[model samples]
Target: MEHSEHTEPRPPGLIGSVSGLVKTTLRLVMSRVELALAELSEVRDHLVKLAVLFALAILAAWFAIAFGTATLVFLVWETLGWKILLILAAVFAVLAFVLVKSAMKLIRGGFLGMPATLAEIKADRDMLL
Candidate 1:
């Protein structure tokens, strides 16, 4: 009798191949995260960009609301009487004040928090090997 070497059989079907692919994908993702951490050094410019974008958004919203209110007042004045239009203007003014106040609060909060957030991201990135 001749002695034969036993060979391991390969796993059959799509499930085994899929599991191997998933594991390889996860490893690649993990390596990319590591590389990103190592590569991320500065965020000051990024924070500044975000701040500018926030400011622009607030300015745009303010201008849009103001323009819309003006247009609405003009329409109302043309259709309704001046007295009713004045009352509407006053009501809109008060609402605008409230909205402005809220928006200012939000801007203040975002401005205060953004630097700290950027700092944290930088610090975390620094800690990565």
Candidate 2:
């Protein structure tokens, strides 16, 4: 009876393998960072647009509300007088508040980071551990 045992050859050196691994890991990190930057850029654009829209809306609403309130207060001054001014002021405050809250809602709708890339990095960390 004859028996044979075959073994694979040893790797040339450890440094080469380590260097290759490091390069690959760095490449992954760079790619993830790029993804994050792109995501941030998109989020920034959306936020900028939201900011501009809210600014215009707030300015226009304030002007219109102010003028309308002044007109109504003038008409009611002889009767209700100062009380009419207070009521108009309250109404204007409420509407302005609503406008601000709506803008906040829009701001909350988006995120400023690359969620997928972050998740991938977390997964990689776990795998390495």
Candidate 3:
């Protein structure tokens, strides 16, 4: 048999490889973006929960403070005379401030830093192929 030197055509060069890599990267990024969006949704939900809880806690605290202050004023007026009402009011005001400040700090440190987004993303990623 006669031998003929022939070479099959090879694939395209660097540009083809780069394009394939880019397409793969884009697919990965799209999947990741979808995951991040899902996470954002969960974060939004948690934010709503936090807002509602914070509002309820603040309202309850305010009611408690108001009732306590009224009781203190009434007691001071009856027992210690009207002069002590002002001192009682001042103490109540300080307590209210402290309570509000501490509550705000706790809310900020706990619910606000809950990382719902990160957790959701991780969970979703784990569920992925």
Candidate 4:
């Protein structure tokens, strides 16, 4: 005759259950932070692009203003002398307009928001609740 011994698995006690929950919570928080960091890097890139574009726009606007003033002076002195300056001023104004429009489009594309991170956080909150 042979005897076999078997033990039933024990359910987690309060401390063990609480420890598991804490670990899970910490993991969730860490993952969310990592996601935010990744998204912030992308945001940094967008910011750099915006900065460069705005700088160019400002430069173009300055050129437009300067040329417009020059054109005004030329118009007062000689009518035909102002034509080239007026054309240059118009070109610079158009360049500034295009740069600002591109910047607006980038902003509209959600370059400033961490969409995925926000969605994940909302999901996590819903799950916990």
Candidate 5:
């Protein structure tokens, strides 16, 4: 006759349980950071677009003033002719204003920061507490 030995699984000690908790928390934080990084990348793309729009607005404004003044002085020397020059100036000014307003909206979009990351962290904190 032969006797068989049986082994039972041991329960996790304090140290093991603590280490597991730490590892899990670290993993959760890392995942949230990855999400934040992705959001920041998106913000970068938006910023580049806004910069281009701002540049265009400045160029339009410059041209409006330069050419409008030149036209008024050289071609539209008469008082009545000044109206057409002023109208052209007004049109370009409007275009520039629109572009500037668009850029401002992007600036205030509140996406420049890690908004999602902050929200996730807040939720995590709330859950933990």
Candidate 6:
């Protein structure tokens, strides 16, 4: 009779490998969620700052326009009469239109989306696929 003395370890079964894969996938999902949450917090902070700046800018601009228009009308009243006021109104309306259009363009540019989280998720998806 021949004697055999092999001491090799067996490979993991499908169930064990699948369980490990599930754990790793869950960990990946959790980490991605954390990243997205962190990015959202950053976006919130940025939005707060932008809102404050926008409010202050609007206040200052209104004050400047009010005082400057009063001074301009006062200075030009002798020559142009009430026509200067009409002209200034038209100019202000045009300027307001332009500013609104610019704001809309900026908003449509996706300035607040979580770009890093999206890219990472896409990369992970591509690797999996």
Off by over 4 Å in 4: 1-11, 76-108
Per-residue accuracy of model 6 over 1-129 as CA lDDT, tens digit each:
565696555687998799889999999999999999999999899889879988999999999999999999999999999999999999999999998998888777876888999999999999999
What lDDT tens digits, residue by residue, belong to model 1 across residues 27-110?
856765665554443445556776898799889988987788778777777667677667766887898799789868866775
Clashes of 4: 0
Query: How high a TM-score does candidate 1 get?
Result: 0.32
Better of 4 and 5 by lDDT: 4
Tell me the tens digit of each residue's lDDT in model 5 across 1-129.
565686565688998899899999999989998998899899899789868976897789789778777866677567566677677768778987996797678668785777778899999999999
Model 2 lowest lDDT segment of ten: 106-115
Please give the lDDT score at residue 83 for candidate 3: 69
Which candidate model has the greater TM-score, 2 or 3? 2
TM value for model 4: 0.66
List, residue by residue over 30-75, the lDDT tens digit for candidate 4: 9999999999999999889879987897899779778887766666
Query: Which regions in candidate 6 have their CA more than 4 angstroms from the true location?
Result: 1-11, 101-111
Q: How does model 3 fare in lDDT?
A: 0.75
Per-candidate TM equals 0.32, 0.75, 0.58, 0.66, 0.65, 0.77
Against the true structure, candidate 1 has what lDDT? 0.69
Please rank every candidate by TM-score, starting with the best: 6, 2, 4, 5, 3, 1
Whichever of 1 and 5 has more TM-score, that candidate is: 5
- Candidate 1 least-lDDT 10 residues: 35-44
- The clash count of every prediction, one per candidate, is 0, 0, 0, 0, 0, 0
Error (Å) of candidate 1 at residue 44 is 6.3
lDDT of each: 0.69, 0.81, 0.75, 0.84, 0.82, 0.93
Candidate 6 is scored at a TM of: 0.77
What clash pairs does model 1 have?
none
Query: What is candidate 3's CA lDDT for residue 5?
Result: 89
By lDDT: ranked, best first: 6, 4, 5, 2, 3, 1
